[model samples]
Target: MKPARPWFSAGPTAKRPGWSLAGLPTDLLGRGIRAPEVVERFAYALRLTREVLQVPDDYVACYLPASDTGAVEAALWAMLGQRPVQVVAFENFGLTWAADVRDHLKLDPEVIEAPWGELPDLSRVDPAKDVVFPWNGTTSGVRVPNADFISNEREGLSICDATSAAFAMPLDWPKLDVTTFSFQKALGGEAGIGVAVLSPRAVARLDTYRAPWPIPKVLRLQDGKGFDRALATGTMINTFSVMTIEDWIDALEWAQGIGGLETLIARTDANFAALSDWVERTDWIDFLAVRPEIRSTTSVCLKFTDPRVTGLPAEDQRAFVKRFKDLLEDEGAVFDMEPHRNAPPGLRLWCGCTVERADVEAATPWLDWAFGEALR
Candidate 1:
């Protein structure tokens, strides 16, 4: 059945009711650093995150540029010049990172890839080698096995792109050397800032692995004494978005007040369970991710099954996309259910904690309505 209205779409997901662009503090131009209080507040916020996540004192949390891509690139440039990079690909973003390793970084990477719906084999990972992969493939709604797959005694660093997973799920930091995330995901912070958390091992790797290529201004982590640990608070780079930093602080406060990361995880889990229940009862729809265990709790993906109405014909597929999108938007039930441009045509909904469970419950019927209308 088509949704009576379509109401769910994967990010930039939904905004919190009181979320406002104006709530952000100014001094994003880096002027905030001049004031000790401002800088202290920022650092304190970062410290709070570390405490909440149970990050060891040896681990440092730094504010990278505004985007998660920036954080990932910074870590790669600083820590990758020595080891042979192994990139694991299960979805579009992972493939993109792998490409960056090849074309931009110009490193010949050993790539282990799986199709969109599947996950890369964790057993194939050699803990002795440097590895890079996304924790959650937001576009495809597939998640990799946690850091438990990587042995603690591995020789190389494990860099994780967890933009969509941070705050929404638990990250096994003991097994992760370098983890990067954007504020936009579960935090619901505006775009432009990325958070990079690194363990002592990761810092050591950066200090030892001097890049063959010239490190750009933003990516370099060393300053004479080798990888300066202090850079984690000040961020080795220049010019930060103070406003974005404060936005992250606000998100962090909300997280703590609402029972922290565990609460957020439960919310997402509940949303996914709700969505899963609905999917089970629906005949025409099925999950793209074959294994329920690996399915992403944050991004719930689906496809229509009633081929009798809109299948087998390419024209019908195109029509289904248009009608489903239009129906959801028109009814205010959901937005942005269309598949990623690069992925198979299917629906992807963000069941993140920032979104209300009531909204998801309210949206299921809209999905049925949308399907019914499209089929008609």
Candidate 2:
């Protein structure tokens, strides 16, 4: 077998070579008298995303101040201060956002939260009210079905956090008003920057709604009429990370070079298929998600199913999993396979296309080895 390239961590994962600033289109930031070509490149990258996802021409796509947190918070700050909020918390991070809405934003939000192991019922959500839901629960490895469930003519805004699902899955942009994602998830680009895509309705809300509390410098999006037009050009706020934005553009270019979004989706599907097949054959392991349809293809989480294995003390199970990660790293077969701290004590593997199939193939043996050693 060919040697494995180290990667597999979720955020800040391995990037394709020749993607640094030195190799980027220098004129994207525009040279002297051009005001940096990078801004236009950034706009172009957003346009490509819009095209790939089939976003409406009237909608605006722009980068945000920080990661998904920044974008989501900006959306909340811009759109929710006036209305009674409803938040759907399915995982740790989602719960964190709910807390932000209540504690930080001081909005008395009715929270519909499910235990970490399961997904909240979408039927319980009232689309007539402003709602916050992640398209894919990255930490929990659960995903929402689709946007068809959301009311098309609802009075309130539908704010979505699609950080992990943006490029990996098909987003119904028409049904979604406010959506945001970070490049680090499936894009494998740099962190510290986020992409915020807003439908015309969302822009209208931002333009119309005024928060009672002071809007932070980073979260402000209103142009003049309370609507955000900066989203159309590149960004609304201030300066952006030129280097990281260039990296994101290159990542898109690389995706296009390979086979575009369709090819990338297929690659993720294949990697998930490999893991799903392996998990089916193993009697000791099983998926955390109860339903196959709801399982996330990007972040595939697994737990020991054998009674003996599960019977081990919770701490012991966690230690065993940690040892499994250490063993895989020692063998140079995988890197950063630990489950997220906020999640159950189980292995959370990223089946992203950024990882070559050969590396995934070579890593399977190490999983067997680690499982055997831990079980023994």
Best by TM-score: 2
> Model 2 scores what on Cα lDDT?
0.78
Per-residue accuracy of model 1 over 1-376 as CA lDDT, tens digit each = 3333333556555655456778766655455564777667767777877765667788888877747888899888777857778998998888998998899889998898999889988888888789998999888888875677888889888999998888788898898999998777876776877778999888887666677788787776777767766667754266666776787777777778888878889988898888888889988788888898789988776766676654557666766878988988886668887887777666888888877777777777887887778877
Against the hidden reference, what TM-scores do the models get?
0.91, 0.92
Mind giving the per-residue lDDT tens digits that candidate 2 earns over 201-224? 888887677887888888878766
Please give the CA lDDT of all the candidate structures. 0.78, 0.78
Q: Over 4 Å off in model 1, which ranges? A: 1-9, 17-33, 234-236, 308-319
Q: Model 2, residue 330: displacement in angstroms?
A: 1.4
**Backbone N/Cα/C clashes per model:** 25, 9
Instruction: Give Cα distance to truth, residue 259, candidate 2, Å.
Output: 3.2
Minimum summed lDDT over a 10-residue window in model 2 is located at 27-36
